[model samples]
Target: MTVTRDSITDFVRTLEDDISRVAICGTSYSDIGGVARVIEQQAIELRNGGYDIDIFTLEGTRKPPEDVSLHALGHFETSPYKEVDKLLTLASPSALNFVRSANRFDLIITHRFPFSTLGHMAKVIHNVPYVYWSHPSGSSDELFEGLAHAWARVQHHLETQNYAVRKADYLCAVSEESGEYIEAKTGREAVVVPNTITESRFGDVADEKKINEQFGLTPHDTIVLHVGRISPRKNIHRLIEAFQAATEGEAECKLLLVGEESMPEYSDRVRELADDDVVLTGFVDDKTLAGIYNRSNVYATCSLSEGWGLPLSEASYFDLEIVAFESIPAVNSLDGAYPVVNEDYDEFREKLCEKVNRD
Candidate 1:
């Protein structure tokens, strides 16, 4: 079922207004992550449509686009302070404050999974509704499919988080898998807003100049772009092997793992395996990422699972052929990329060669 906030009463669209103000709430936009990029992309589209946009962040780590207006809301606890957040969310006093503060927005959209519970509480407290962007990675049956014998506490947190997803005005996600998951948990139909890829990102920019200068890239080098937080869930190790295999005989191929390194150990592992052909940008800006995408020949993602792979869409904008696995959600998201089934080394290797050599 669809719900609306008290402030957003205007059903009629004003075509003449040059500024359509929109607010985006989320955990962190600093890492150039999926949720951040989703909101940012929409904000850009609206701005291009001659609408003024506003993005509200509790932490305010990342800056909004130059054209978009920015409003800083109250800050919340980080990952380490999860318990504190849960406590404040439950207590009536703190909950009342949350409602009072967010009542001003015409439409408040949140990316945090637990914030949906806040949205439910806020609607009752302030009569202001909220739209939730669904991207929860865990299954309701479990936090994740594969887990150890331990993690009882983690499992409990996962269950409580579903309460948030279960309550929201509008549920939006990038793919059907996540949409289905949100519907099953929220008892609401979710809109499928596939990730976007504009033509401008596949061009040169000032951010690339900074990255090239800092990373020591030659004009002739072909950088293979992997844009995301370098995490195990991302299956970064598999990408290493695939890139390594593809660049075996190639002269200019270089694997560029953009975004900050998730862990120092993982960062070290990347270095241990790389010859001189690998470059780690470690949290490059958006413009740099776009330039890297332009200079890149092919894009590859070795994720075990993905609700929606945003980079895959970005690659499509540049017409870069994809080399991915033939899994349910992954294959479905690739659109028309060459997907090789099975994770066997040889099978993956053969497919990798095919993608890299494509004319």
Candidate 2:
């Protein structure tokens, strides 16, 4: 269905203290990456605004706020058929219970794929309306790049997500690129609600010197940072290769890879391609990460795809020089981000070198 500005405004108005509950469901609820962070923050804001919330999700390392109801279903372990696993999880005993009791909530909001299918099920079974919230209208190889089973897996996701999009009452796109894709693919209008950074959390004090000391760096050291899960689609190996070429004649350019390893083998490959100048801080706290962003000369990513590049947004907020592929919408939206054509590795390297060596 077409989602207009008035409809969105009406929806917000309906989210008053009088509403009993709102269900926010997603594929995962961990600090694992962007989707989790966005859902967590949305839930927090909704609850704070006097709306009661229930969080339904697949198993994840992080848990929701205690005040809200949490219905975590499914396994924590990775599987070869993730799309099939999601379908099974949604059909699980706990999920069936949710289906039966879904009327308790005023609205169901779904994040990412597959879970949107679950929310669609709620719409079909309980006559509830579900809001589809995610990007990349259909799965593309961009997400599963470097993985052996990428072709088949992405095809499965594409089919499932297409169905989810069709069933959703309304769509919420996190960026203009995604909104356009949704409109073109599904022939449905989507409300664009961009991802945001909490200024209070990201803006306070940061000790650049202390951060550099912690990383064993010096005044001459130029840090190029990439903050995201160590995944195949991130094309981090390309970033590593570019960093090498960019700093070949530099004084001392360092590349810091932060965030958890989503794929161990991929992470290992990144490490194997690295030298002394590459540092991997698996994952750090918010304060530490903010400090590192402050200390870094440039924030870079060679990701093949993104719904919305939250790391790039955060980097832009931190006032770091941004460098990323033009295909990434969030980076392109920023004021000073240096965006190069997606597949132009040579130009990417040159831009990185210029930003790093800039006074």
Candidate 3:
């Protein structure tokens, strides 16, 4: 994600005009996620643009920063409480009703999930101009011919996701590469607006030492951090394997998982992985997590796919050298994120060992 300053300047230009009312819809709004954080960043900017942003959340009441003026309207999952939320997503009927209630908005900006399907309905039914926000791709069609995947669910997801993108009045991608991928997939050129940074995590340097102490880590320990859903798409298991492999001889390395687990089986699997070196502190506060980022010896993810890796960007903000698989949407941004080809255990080991030895 090599960006010319002009592109950022131009993207900021679109916000000059005052926006009145906007329905910012997404499931992850209340949770700790890269995409959710990206959406939260936009909600703040839109609020500054004079738009009163009304959020349709799937769950939780975690408010956005004060300057952003965002409010959650709903929640979806129950267990980890923060488990996957589906606010206003087509998968839920409450979302359908929100679209009806949100008809007064001048525009709608959707991120990830249900927004794609609901945005179209918001337009066709209420005459609202829906803006489709693209984040990251969770697929690699390199193995498949024209279709993204031969698996029925993967194929269905693409077909459905394509319909949602093509139906939007305007599309804003989190990254230019994602925009190009969307254009090639849907025959519609989307506008690229990569995820912006909040001053605390990006503009200002974090106190890693302060944050690490709060996480119960000694100054000498090397804490490897991962922040994303504990779901399958994040490729957490692979990260565990890599970490286990990377730290066999290094006695000082530790791994900390910051987000809430997403599924029963997934949680069980991860819990099963608990041992001397791994710490699972499910869903810490943003301030605390930022502190942990500051204290990290290295930050990494083996995310198999993404719309864009928000954590990766945040990791870069802290200047922590990262290690990740290069295929993820955010791979392009990780100049410091040492990438290994996905599942290339050998190559992953090589990179991990190099980073550890260099550290």
lDDT of 2 by residue, 1-359 (tens): 43433323345454443555788887787766788777776777677766788888876567676588777776423566454455456556777787788888878888865567777888888878788875663345544544445654654454334787766887787787877777776777777777766454565556877787788788778889999988777888999999999999676889999989867777889899998888988888777888988888899999867788888988888788888988888877897798899889999999998898783
List per-prediction Cα lDDT, in the order shown: 0.61, 0.76, 0.68
* Residue-wise C-alpha lDDT for candidate 1, range 216-295, written one tens digit per residue: 88776666777777766666777888888866888866777777785566677767876788777788665667767766
Give all TM-scores, in the order shown: 0.75, 0.88, 0.80
Q: Report the error of model 2 at residue 185, Å.
A: 1.9
Runs with alpha carbons beyond 4 Å of true place in candidate 3: 1-19, 67-97, 101-103, 139-162, 201-216
Q: How many clashes (backbone N, Cα, C below 3 Å) per candidate?
A: 5, 0, 12
Number of the predicted model whose TM-score against the real structure is largest:
2
Residue 315, candidate 1: Cα error in Å is: 1.9
Q: Between 2 and 3, whose lDDT is larger?
A: 2
Candidate 2's TM-score: 0.88
Question: So what's the TM-score on candidate 3?
Answer: 0.80
lDDT of 1 at 309: 72
* Alpha-carbon lDDT of model 2: 0.76
